[model samples]
Target: MEISMSTIAFGFIGFKATDFAAWDSLDYISKHRDQGEWTGLYIAEDEATAKGYLSDKINNSGNGIAYLHKVSVIRPGKLITCLDQSFKTGNIDIPALKQAMRDKGINVEDTDKLTEKLGQLGYYFRCFNNEDGAIEMIIPVELVTNVDMQLYKTCIAKSFVFSCQ
Candidate 1:
């Protein structure tokens, strides 16, 4: 599983496959895939992506199975903080980032507070963990309107992946 906090840039709205029928149905998948770059329906490749995508889906659609909803998009520089399990140990440090932010006169007590504040500003948090123990945390600083901190908290609580708190 992966855990961290950061920001994202854009959000995508579309349908997602929910069952074996939807998963195995090439025609259905193809049709949705043809809609746009990140539009239509999609089958999550792993538990992490599914959890992240589903949480966003539920927040937007109130359904976890197959549904249409808005999902955040993260690019390289858009992330405020990223805790990636794939990175070599000690390569990227959260504390260092915090210090850097503080050095730049950004009032950041810690990563959690920083992320929480960012969340209020249209950024959403995502945690993903595959069955293989791979985990990642992402906080996308996108333009989310009427930000729902409670919904995000609930989503994190229900996520099968690691919890933020």
Candidate 2:
């Protein structure tokens, strides 16, 4: 009973809102803020690494199963709009930051505009504080085939067999 591991590019997609209406409403941003569920795709090097991270960081109270998909060989493109350590000190100036990004040719006036642009490109925008206490806003573009249900089932079955042994 040996578990096989490979260095695969994995993608984890999470939903901001439960329904499409809530996601598309004018107050969608506020909803996400209030619910604290604006997370996007998290890429990991392999299944084991992703499982460990997701179990610790994502699977709250052991109630949720992490959705991990084997992505294509093409690495997802990352567009880092902001990386500010001042946010850790609670000195974030929103307007000034937006102007700065505009000056940097990012073409984004606000978070909403950034989300819209990313959505149009079939990508997801996520903002969070990195481990070093820096505010990071990133857009992860998913450039791969859709999840193969049969393959996923086979992988799960093999994992179960290996674990039970």
Candidate 3:
């Protein structure tokens, strides 16, 4: 489960060899695979690639994939996905999240202010636990727009989160 989630996240950065997006668009793309194929969100680079993959799966393996969807992974705003068990107890692993951001060359000082700014923009953290003893923070792509660049640039000196092709 952890591996699947990480793979999905990495897809946003174009790390997957064959791009695969969820057939149901954003609805199934972020869900766990245990919920069945219909609920599983696959990652793809674009619509053509996603369609090709879907065709192959249905033709070759008789997969019940009748529809394909194109979703916009690129958003004007950014949401941080944090995986930590402490979130289940209503506590956030702020230090870990900040350190991860720092490792990505994003300036994450003034953590409180950073979160506050995100909250002001209606991009609050949504925590999820798959009973894997870790919480995953995910934001719907629709709600990931209207970013305040002024505050974003202040906290992030450099980051791929805001860079998309």
* TM per prediction: 0.31, 0.37, 0.29
| Model 3: colliding residue pairs | 19-44, 20-42, 20-43, 20-44, 21-42, 21-43, 21-44, 29-41
TM-score between model 1 and native: 0.31
Better of 1 and 3 by lDDT: 1
Residue lDDT tens for model 2, 23-63: 12234333333222223334332344334343342233443
List the candidates ranked by TM-score, beginning with the highest: 2, 1, 3
Task: State each model's C-alpha RMSD to the native.
Answer: 14.4, 11.7, 15.6
> Candidate 3 regions off by >4 Å?
1-77, 117-126, 129-165
Least accurate stretch of 10 residues (summed lDDT) in model 2? 147-156
Per-candidate Cα lDDT values, in order, are 0.36, 0.35, 0.34
For model 2, what is the error of residue 127's alpha carbon versus the real structure, in angstroms, after optimal superposition? 7.7
- Best-matching candidate per lDDT: 1
lDDT of 1 by residue, 16-43 (tens): 3132211222444344432321132222
In angstroms, how far off is 51's CA in candidate 3? 34
lDDT at position 158, candidate 1: 37
Best by TM-score: 2
Tell me how candidate 3 scores on lDDT.
0.34
